[model samples]
Target chain A: MAIRDDFEVVASQVRTVVQRFALGLLVIAAFGAMLVGKADTVLVEHARVLALDVVSPVLEAIARPVAYANRAIADLREFASLREENARLREENARLLAWQTAARRLENENEGLRSLARFREGPEASFITARLVGDSVSAYMRGALLNVGRRVGVAPGQAVVTGEGLAGRIAEVGENSSRVLFVTDVNSRLPVLVERTRERAILAGDNSPRLRLTLLPSIAGVQTGDRIITSGHGGSFPVGIPVGEVVETSDGSVRVRPFTDFSRLEFVRVVDYGVTGLVGTGAAAPAPATPPGGTAVRSR
Target chain B: MRVDGTLAILDRWGRAALPGTVLLFFVLLTLAPLRAPYLSDTLPLLPVLVVFQFSLAAPERLPGPLLLAMGILLDLLLGGPGAPVGVSALGFVLVRAAVMSNRRYLVGVPFLFQWAGFCILCWGFVALVWAFTTLWTWALIDPVPAILQYVVVVVIYPLIAPLLARVRARDPLNVPELSRGSARPGETTP
Candidate 1:
């Protein structure tokens, strides 16, 4: 019994000591991570890339059921509204047919005007469709994973969109997968213009659902619900892609309600507008699809 | 030192399995964002919750360093936000330290205070995240969203509490009797 008590005491003391050491080590580790993060070491980044490469397939497998469920839900909703949807589509088609006639007239007139001015040709815009397989949805960060990658001509700075509108841009591309940096991501900034007044502003991400517009002239004609579109100023995105509608927050600060419904995202189109020397992870730099004379593509 | 052979084996695997499952559970949870009806773009930190649970009930199983490592790994797993690398790591460490310092009060306390303690400790964690993000961006992120996220997480704790309790109830690793045997602490075997 005495020996037993001694052993227990020894064990307890040793355990306490070890616990303290572990705590100290944890504190050190916390500091170490901060240092490493700030350092942005190439080796550490490559390791993270390798780790993601391994995990993405597993994430994709998990996403399959989710995708199925989403599709099933959408189909159910569509079936429920079949009659109403058909009526709405018929009306929309009729309206579009009339608008199409007007737009064709405008197109021919614009082409004649452009030809008379000896205008250069626009860069060809092509798209690669990709499925979202994973997402990092923390309060601080927002990005999604795409199944397509450098293998499919997906490159960093390539804009990603949905049927709704601009969703995000490809930030990092790997061999078989890539990450889309959402417009709401803190690092994202795109040049935009108010569709009405043509006022230019920088749409900045503050980790909020609505993006904040910076550098808008105080006297510029921006109003609630005004449509914002890309200006194609920086060669990042082709001009005229619908971004969002402007809104004034409760605090009187301006924000944009993005055209894309971020939560319901399933698939996105990766659009290459051919900006060469943009940020990319590709080892072999591919030439931009830009035509000579640096004529920027105009996207819909 | 050996008890029932099967129980020993279960206990042996349970040490790694329990914490690992908790870690993986949260990581998976984070992959989907909670949208509007709840706070948008906000996700409850699973590792923080798991670390909080272990620090209160079974500090020996998790260890502060393990929590820290898990935090760092989680941060690495979702790296686009520009959050400092060690924010989660440090947050978990702080949570562990907070729970450990008050483990005596927290462990045997009523469920209310235990949860309240978790809620209180979560503020510091959220604050650290907000402060770090502000530093990273060189701009102040509105504190309302971060505070809202904390409130949401606090609300979620009750729902998660039952799942954790279930995991603990079935835990073979840290049963009181198993904790007191000749195997002692620091031995991989419980």
Candidate 2:
């Protein structure tokens, strides 16, 4: 009995020592991984995509129920305000009817002019609707994982949008899953034009709900509610896609609130305008056309 | 007699593996699409709480290698351009280190005291992650979101701690440690 007790104690001590050594090694390995991730972005990105692909199926299964639950909750809320919503929709429908008639007239005139000039058409825009399987949107990162990827021709840099307007663009693609980098992420920089004034600027995200407009023309005037749209300078997104409206303009800094409701995002349409300029095919991003009185910025 | 011994060994191994397995599940839970405004940002910290609870409950079972794997997996799931990937692994190790250093006092303390210790340590971990992120990006990051996440975690801790404590109480190894005639609880071995 005495010998057995001694053996157990020795074994315990040895185990303790081994555990300590392992803890030290793991701490070092963690630090090493951090350094490697910083140095080699491609490796990290590949690993991230692979991980997403592996987890997406499971996320998809979970998303269905969660999406249903969210819809139910929204429905309950909407039911409480049904009368107000119906009245507002009725008013908006009447306004849209008048605009629809004007739009039809303009389309007819534009089509006649195009044929008379023999104007060549740009690459046709195509779309694939995908369900959102995962959401990584946070204060630091704004991204969503989709169930569609290269298998469905969902390439990187394709514009992602909802019925309302622009949401984001594809940042990474795997076999069955892809990631959308939202317009609100710090790394996202988009070329936009103030629709009313036709003045160009760079819309930059700083990991905030509102995006900031940078590189604005010094002489250009912008208002608080000026509409913003893709300038089509960058071939990644189509021209004139409604992005957002300027919510605030103070001290020469303008903030935009995107039309897409990020919190309630469930389904998104990925648009392929067939222009794989910078992100998709490794071609250089085109520089924004410099209007007079403004320096041009690269649309990246 | 041999069969009884085999069953005993299997039970011990199963118990040893439980905490790590549950922690892994918590990691997966973080990625689930439970969409709400500001939810994705705050839910990432759920695994951190799991790590803390398991580190206190069964430090031996929840070893460094498993924590490293869990953190790296979470990093891979969350990582993207401009996002720190392996920093999560570093954070896990740091949390483990913090808990290990204070294990003796924490395991012996009352529930309230343990709760308080957890609050302090969780805040410290959040601050450390914020600092690392700011440094990695070399830009000034707004601290409000991280602080809000910390607040949410603290509020949710009470609901989670008792459940983890129950798991600890049911652990077979826990009884042996208590009966080892140690002056305080959880001081049998480091």
Tell me the interface RMSD of model 1, in angstroms. Answer: 4.0
Interface RMSD of each: 4.0, 2.7
Kindly list the per-residue Cα lDDT of model 2 for residues A1-300, writing each as its tens digit: 999999999999999997768667777898888888777766777888888899899889888999899999999999999999999999999999999999999999999999999999888999999999988755577788999999989887788999988998888889999988888887677888999999988888877789999989852388888899988776667889999999998887888999988888889999988876444321112234433321122222
Measured against the true two-chain complex, the DockQ scores of the candidates, in the order shown, are: 0.40, 0.52
Alpha-carbon local distance difference test for all models: 0.71, 0.78
Worst 10 residues of 1 chain A by lDDT: A291-300
List, in the given order, the native-contact fraction of each candidate.
Answer: 0.57, 0.68
Task: State which candidate has the highest lDDT.
Answer: 2
In angstroms, the error of model 1 at B188 is 33
lDDT of 1 by residue, A141-256 (tens): 66888888778887777889899889877766678888788888776777888899998888877768889987787534677889988887757578889989988744446788
Question: What residue runs in model 1 are displaced by over 4 Å at the alpha carbon?
Answer: A1-19, A41-44, A74-86, A112-117, A218-220, A223-225, A248-254, A278-300, B1-11, B33-42, B169-190
Model 1 CA RMSD to the hidden true structure, in angstroms: 7.4
- TM value for model 1: 0.81
TM-score of the first chain of model 2: 0.87
